[model samples]
Every structure is written in C-alpha cells, then in structure tokens.
Target chain A: MPNILVVEDSPTMRQLIGFAMKRIASSRVIEATDGIDALKKLSSEKIDLILADINMPVMDGLKLVSLVRSNPAYKDIPIIIITTEGAEEDKKRALAIGANAYLPKPIQTQELIKLVNSFISQ
Target chain B: MERETSIGKKADEFLQLFRKGEEFTHEILKENERLRFKLAQLEEAIERSGDEAKIRLYEERIKFTEDELNSLKERFRQVEEENKDFAAKYVEVEDENNNLANLYVASYQLHSTLDFNEVLRIVLEIVINLIGAEKFSVLLIEEKTNELIPVGAEGISISDVPKVRFGEGIIGTAAKEGESYFSENIHNLHNRGSISTETPIVCIPLKIKEHVIGVIAIYSLLLQKEKFSNVDYELFNLLAGHAATAIFSSRLYTQSERKLTTIQSFLDMLKEKPRR
Candidate 1:
C-alpha cells in the first residue's frame, strides 16, 4: 500500500479527503492537523506522497516543502501542494522549494485526484 | 277412482302399522344415541391430527421460501459490489480524460491569444509539460540591438534578462549560427564571462526568414543531465516559430497604432492652420 500523508488544519476537510482517497486507493492514510504533526509523522513512517495545505499553524506548507526538499532522504518523495495561492510567483516559489505538483483550492475532487495520481504513478 | 281407492287403503294400513310400532321406536332411539357418541369421538381425533398436518406443511413451505430469499440477497450483494467497482473505475478514467481535455485547452490557449507575453508563457508551459523538460525559456530578438530578450521563461533561473546580449552569449552563438544548437554544458558554450554559473543546458535558435530571430534554452536540475534529443529539438522549434509569428503580429499592431495616432495628430495640426 502506498502511504499518503494528508496535512490539513480543518477536521472536516481531513475526513472528506480521507474518505475520497480511501474508496479509490486502498492504502493507509495518515492525517496531521498541522505541519508540525506532519513532520513528526514523516519522521516515523515511510510516506510515498503528501497532500498539504498552504496555510497552517505551527508550520506552514511552504516551510514544510523546503524542509522536506532540504533533507536528502525525503527529497525524492513527491509532494503535491493544495493551496489557495494562484499567483505565478507563488507557484514559482512552490516549485522552487521542491513541490512536485500543485493544485489550487476550492479544488475539484477530480482535479485533486488526478494530481495525486500523477505523482504516485512514478 | 279405482287408483284413489287403492292409495287410501294403503294409507289406512300404514297408520294401523305405525300405532303398533311404539315398542320398536323405543329400541331405535337407544341405538341412535350410542352411534351419536361414537361420531363425536371421531371428530375430536381428526381435529388434533389436522392441526399437526397443517403446521408441518406450512413449515416446509416457509423453509423453501427463506432459502429463495437468502439467494436473492446474496445476488443483490454481488451486483452491488460489481456496481461499486465499475463506478470507481469510471470516476478514475473520467478524471484522467478531463485532465487530458484540460491539457488540450491549455495548449489551445497558445493558438488563440495574439498577446505576445501570454502566448510565450502558454507555449513554454505546454512544451515543458510535453517534453518533460526540467526548465525552458523563450528569448525574443530585439529588433534594434539584435540582442535576444527573454520575453518568457520558466523552469530555469538565469535572470538579468532586459540587458542581455546575443552574439557572445550561448543564445548569441545560436543566433550567429542561424541554426538550432544543443550544448550539455552552457558554461562551455558561453565564454562571455557574462553568465557566472556553470550549468548543463541546451540552447536552440528560433528562426524566421532564414534568419535567427530568437533563442531557446532548457536546463535540467543539477542532478538530471540528459541531453536534449531530436524530438525536443523539433518540438521546441515548432513552438518557438508559432510564438515568433504571434510576436510579429503583435509588433505590427503596435506599429500601425502608432502611425494612426501620428496621422491623427497631423490632421489636428492642419485644423489649427489659419485661412489666408
């Protein structure tokens, strides 16, 4: 099973995303309410993909991406960012910081799954 | 009359016989009571056996019906499972197709807009996705200086675009050759001391009228060092040509607008002339 780590601050969104992923990809899903929690989970378990929100307390998604890329061990793992930042500069920054894929929110469920699939396909 | 006389005589004989039959009537009554008691006993036996028979028959029917219901429920579950699997696969395939459509839409954005900046941006992005290149750039030739100007760039980091040259830089060499060139080492290709960093890259010329008008360079990350293939060369060449044509149209529009404004001003100046 490909392990997916979902890092979001909202509980409702967490459950909804988890439910959607579960029905399609029968893999273990680990949820973290904040980036700090996500980082801890990343340390303990092997994660194949990450679906992260941009704005989160404790540690934001951008910072998490930088941290992940900076680590040699985690750099190869594909991270798909889910965010409200639609600006080109933001996209540039995200890609520069080692985000493999990006999706803007109020994300269509189909679009989100496609982006997810692209990363996990490798 | 004779027949009626015979019937009346028989009736008188029967009445006389009935009057003498009282002793026989008492004996018949005793036998009828004994037979009535035996009939009631037989009816009780049937009532007890009939209930057992009816219950056994119903229980057998119920067992058969319950077996059928269970089979139906099992079939329904199997159908439901198959339906769920198909629906999930449909959703997955549908999402993939929509992205394919979206990609086409994004690609079509290049052919629609004549805006130079947006066109360059769209084409480079499409090519980037198409070729799976780590980075890409589009440099339009400045008409006056003949210097390649980086109008649109993505997937690479080499700024100082507005004041860049064409003859001596990697782009300049491609322009001088008037042919698409690929160099794995950009630092080896560029000796101008202009670009300080050493990175592996590919440089291609965007040609028009058999004259090199612009240059394109794609760079991979420091890790990936695969050189550009013939396919990348051709794809980028086509994209760059379309982009250059769009640029020419936009530049033409701007020039004509300037001329129109100048003519209008000249006509206004004539209106201010005094009649002799």
Candidate 2:
C-alpha cells in the first residue's frame, strides 16, 4: 500500500479528503494541519504523494509546493493542490509552482479518486 | 468336261461376290451404331455444359446481388451519418440564433421604457430567465459616498445584504477600477469579506463610457449549468453598457418628470389664488 499525505487546516476537509482517498484505494494516509506540520511528517515518513490545501495558518500550499520542489529528496513527488480558488491566475500560479494538479473546491468525489489512483499508480 | 469346269468357276465367283457384299453391310451397321452412341454422348456433354454455364450465371447473379445489397447498405449508413451530422449542426445553429435573439430582446427591453424600477426588473429577468443565474444582486453606486447600494436582489434576504465600499471588496474593486471581475469559484470573494451567503460566480461592473455606475453580482449558477459559457460573457459585456445607459436614462426621465410636476403644481396654486 502507498503512503499518502493530506495537508489541510480544516478537520472536516481533511476527513472528507481522507474518506475519498480510502474509498478509492487501500493506502496509508498521514494528515497534517498545515505546511509546517507537513514538513515535519515528511522528514520522518516515506510519503508517496501529497494532497494539500492552498490556504493555511502557518504556511500556505503554494509555499509548501515551492519548498518541496527545492528539496532534492522530495522534488519528484506528485503534489495535488485542492482549494476553493478557481481563478485562472490561481491555477496558473499553482501549476507554475510545480504542483502536479489543481482541483477546485466542491470537489467531485469520483474525479478526485480517479486522479489519486492515477498519481499513486504512477 | 471343259464346259462343267467353266460353269463351276462362274459359280465360285458369284458366291465370293455375295460374301463380300454381306461383310460390307455388317461393317456399315457397326459403324452406324458407334456413330449413334458418340452422338448421344456429345448431346449429354452439351446438356451438362449448358447446365454448368447456367449454374455459373446464377452464381454470378447472386454475387452481384449481394454486392449491390452491401453497396446499398453502405450508402444508407453514410446517408444516416450525414443526416446525424446535419441534425447536430442544425441544433448548434439554432442555439446560436436563440442566444442572439435573447440578446436582441434584452436590449430592446432595457430601452423600452424610462422607468428605473422597470429597467431593474428587466435586467433581473434577463439574468434569471435567459442567463440562468440562480442568485444575483444589482447594486447602484452612490455618487456621494462611492459605495454600492443594493437596489434589487434575488436569493438573498434584504436584511442580510451588506453595503460594499468602493475599492474595498471585489464588487467595490470592480466598481473602482471600472473593470469586470468573474470568479469561477466564490471562495476568493469570501476570503476578502465581500460575500457571506453563497459564492458569486460572476461580478460585472455596469459601465457607460469607462464610468462604472453600478455592479451586478451573480452568486451562483443553476444546477444545470456547471460554468459560464462564451455566450454568458457576451451577455455580460452587453449588460455592462446597455444596463448602465438604461438606468441612467430612466433616472434622468424620472427627475425631469418630477420637476415638471412640481412646476405645474406651483403654477396651478398661483392661478387658484388669483381667481379667489
């Protein structure tokens, strides 16, 4: 089973994402409240993929993506940004920052599952 | 004795001639029988060859018929595909025509009367019925304060509507810059403290000659529409100019009408005083 990391500020959002992921495939999910917590988990655990929210308290998703991209060890890991910011500029910035994919809020459960499965299998 | 010997020789010659004639007759009979058998064999062969030719002809005809049938089927299939294509194109063209018609009707209705409330009603109708927006609000800019005041709204309680200052929120920013702001996700506005109820999918500034007079906030689309189409954007552009003009003209007409009524009443009062 692959280990997945979910970084979000909201507990409900984290649970929703976790439920969607677990329903799609049997995998280990490590939850983090924000980017700072995510980094802490990353150092100790071998994470296969990351699903992160854009807005957070300590560090935002964009900053996390930039930091992850700069790190040589975790540079190649796939990062999917899920946020309520569906503007064209937001999408462009996320993709430019090395995020693998961007999913808008009011997330389609099946599409999210499919996207996760594709990334994990890859 | 000489005479007897001569007579015997003539008798022997006659008997030999008779035997030769009999042998010739038998040979002719045998030859005739052989020719009849060969003729029968040739006739049977000819008949069999004729039957084979007929069979070959029938086989060719069957093959030809099958090929013709297949060709016809292919033609039918192609025609059906063409018809389907034509039908799809027709529907597409019809949809385009309907959109254009709607724009025309909306333009006409906006300019139909100089009543400000009527103009707002018509705009709301176009937004709801034609554009398929479920929730929307029309806010006019107060010239003195440079704040947006909601004149009309749907899917929002009047008590809950918040006044937006110019250059503050998305609506205010749109009005301040005289630019339209369309957000596919409403959370961006929520982040800035503009909208509290539902997310607005579109925010358009009603402009007349680079001057934004008002703003239209579309909160959400109908369930059927996942996103705004190009046509919706076109409609937005149209509303930006035409809606502003309509509202401006109606306000002017109303003000002028009010002034005229006041003057007429004053004249009537003076005339009555003189008659008394």
What DockQ, on C-alphas, does every prediction get? Answer: 0.04, 0.01
The TM-score leader among the candidates is 2
Candidate 2 per-residue C-alpha lDDT over A1-122 given as tens digits, one digit per residue, 9 for 90 to 100? 88899998855456657766765567989999999999999999999999999988999999999999999999999999987666778989999999999987645555677898999888
Against the reference, the lDDT scores of all candidates come to: 0.68, 0.81
- Model 2 score (lDDT): 0.81
User: What does the lDDT read for residue B81 in candidate 1?
Assistant: 100
Itemize residue pairs with steric clashes in candidate 2: none
Residue pairs clashing in model 1 are B166-B172
| Model 1 lDDT tens row, B114-150 | 6565566565645444344445566767879867777
- The alpha-carbon lDDT assigned to residue B39 of candidate 1 equals 80
Candidate 1 residue spans exceeding 4 A from truth: A1-122, B1-107, B127-137, B152-169, B185-200, B221-234, B272-276
Minimum summed lDDT over a 10-residue window in model 2 chain B is located at B186-195
* Candidate 2 structure quality by residue, lDDT tens digits, B17-122: 8898899898999999999999999999999999999999999999999999999999999999999999999868855754565567668778988999888878
Model 1 lDDT, residue B135, Cα: 50
> TM-scores for all candidates?
0.39, 0.59
- Model 1's lDDT to the true fold? 0.68
State in Å the error of residue B78, model 1: 31
